[model samples]
Target: MVRLQNPVLKKELKLRFRSFKSFSAIIFYLLTLLVFTVGFFLVVTDFKGKGFIGPEMNVVLFTMLTFVQLSLVLFMTPGLTAGAISTEREKQTLNILLTTSQTSWQIIFGKLTSSISYLLLLLLAGMPISSVVFLFGGISPSDFVLTYAYMIVILIALASIGILMSTLIRKTIVAMITTYGIMLFLTVMTAFFVFVTLSVQTGFDGSELGGQKPFSYFFMAINPLIHMASVIYPEVSESALTVTSMDLPLWVTHISFYVIITVLCLWIATKNIRVNMK
Candidate 1:
């Protein structure tokens, strides 16, 4: 059984809260979410028109909030975790950690959980406002769960990427940038690549209009955003062939890719930390 008594996690959690920058970041994040949600609400209710929101708008509102929150998660989680190990190395404290009773894997997992704990705070704090969609009554509990569950999976995958980069790179800033660059490749470049490829094959206007090739499905499978869109609209598979020729849903492939990434990245990180031990 995995142990929950990680001293490193406890220590980092304490220090994170004690830091002024951490508090300020939390405050700023919450304020931005609050204001954005309020403005959305005002616009939805039609400040000059309907003065009230209807149930029909629930899906639209939830879609907007979900995508916005997902974007924030993608942006913030990498920053928080990309410095996890590299920051310690910068302070010459990683040697201290290496000498501790904790295994390198323990250290890796501990730092990861501590960093994700802060991200959890941001996600949970935003929930009440996002829940306004639930009150209006179009989004089912199952839909909500699927969307967020995939999000958590994506965060774990991204966090693992950050941890691996943090382990490999000596400079925290460089590691952070590299981690985000990888994220950009996964999220944006992959999508663009598929689009350009499709355009070339089918023509820009799709005048020839050949069916989607299997190669396109591969890109869509790797992209978190595309899968998240599938989750939002079940009908998407009907349109995009679930971004794959396979019978399984696109999310199944999306999650499978992320799971492999998380495990592979963590394994590489643990191995690196062990190899560098002096």
Candidate 2:
């Protein structure tokens, strides 16, 4: 096995830990989860008793919480990764790093991985809260596994997008804005396309017009949020709110494609760095 040297990973992790950005993000997410869980418990308890919430309600709450968490990840991931490389260039540190024995790919991965580690830690911190939801009775162990796995895939995809933007842009501000713009485009535009497609197909019929079909299937396969929502609540497939449906098999295919794309982006970034160095 090839051991990766990542001095920057340790340094960046320490820096991120000490910074308010990481601290605030983790604290904010924890507090939000706590408030939601407490409010949910209170509503259920007030309505009847512990049994009132039931297993289905618990599952619903867990699924909702997972959705909210994924949204947070989507919004914050670009912030973490968009400046990783461009910021180094801005600070005139790229030459120093290039002079070292560390390969460009290693540098890129180290920065990307280190940034993601902080977010993953925050997600893991919420695991106990998620488990507590299980205590109330709706979610299964399989649900937890699927939810976490989806989160991991989402993080990788977002980080790759950010890193690609970082490598392409020289200024940190431009990179940040561009990264976020792309994220918004991906999440919002794809959803809009799905909606428009469905509308044109069924004329707002009650039946789901998208999913495992031609155009709809292609977009649905790529949208992480859509894939996860479908997996958690299959009933959403029949709802007007559901723009697309995605099964576990579709999720796996999407994740595989995203991973391959990320690898390609990393390779390109490495090549860019090497060419610039030369």
Candidate 3:
């Protein structure tokens, strides 16, 4: 949590909590997750037609729930953060921030922290929905915790992108749209490119990591979904997602890529703000 002394963070939090949308967000998230969980159980088990959910089915349920949670956060976080700076500009308060005592980095981070606070709240509120998996007997506490850790990392990464776009675009709507497009590129387009490349190389042969094709692996490392898959299935097959001769797991590279992305985006956004302040 950012210190309350951060005036920007304090102000933003106050504004978000006072707004009706914030309350609506909590209700919407819980209801959506509850509906999905129940719907998945009913459909998968044929309305409990097949009794006794074995460990295998529990694993599937866990995977589904994890991805669903990831999806909800993914869709919501960009909308929250896309206006981080642009909205301030639109309100003519960006200059007001500059005249304050905080540094550029502090201001940007304050915006980011405030934006994500609600998302974190939603994650906490939805835990009971996710915890239902434990009643079966497949997903462990470690897996549950790790899944959340990955979500937070991805959320921060995506929010950083939103912050960068908001800083660069100067319009909330454009920033929001561009942020969504970039996220789509990072997830969908990367997978599509990999599929196409693998298909062309082997005339649609099975996707396998062979030879010294680091570039192909590089693409995989940048996609956040890869990291999620790695966490979901810790015993993932090496040949299915390895970087040929690379010694480390693919997920490590994926996390590293996002970390770099976060740092780089924050730096660039802060630099842009400072330049404008002069």
Task: List TM-scores for all candidates, in order.
Answer: 0.91, 0.86, 0.91
- Model 1 alpha-carbon miss at residue 199, Å: 2.0
What's model 1's overall lDDT? 0.84
> What local distance difference test score does each model get?
0.84, 0.78, 0.83
The 10-residue segment of model 3 with minimum total lDDT is 237-246
Which rank order by lDDT, best down to worst? 1, 3, 2
What is residue 132's positional error in candidate 1, in angstroms? Answer: 0.4
lDDT of 3 by residue, 205-262 (tens): 5565456666566666677676687787865526545534456667778789889999
Residue 59 accuracy (lDDT) in model 2: 80
Candidate 2 or 1, higher lDDT: 1
The alpha-carbon lDDT assigned to residue 143 of candidate 3 equals 91
Which lDDT tens digits does candidate 2 get at residues 74-191? 8889988999999999999888988888887788888998988988998998888778876777566887888888788878878988888898889988988998887787678777
> Residue 119 of model 3: what lDDT?
88
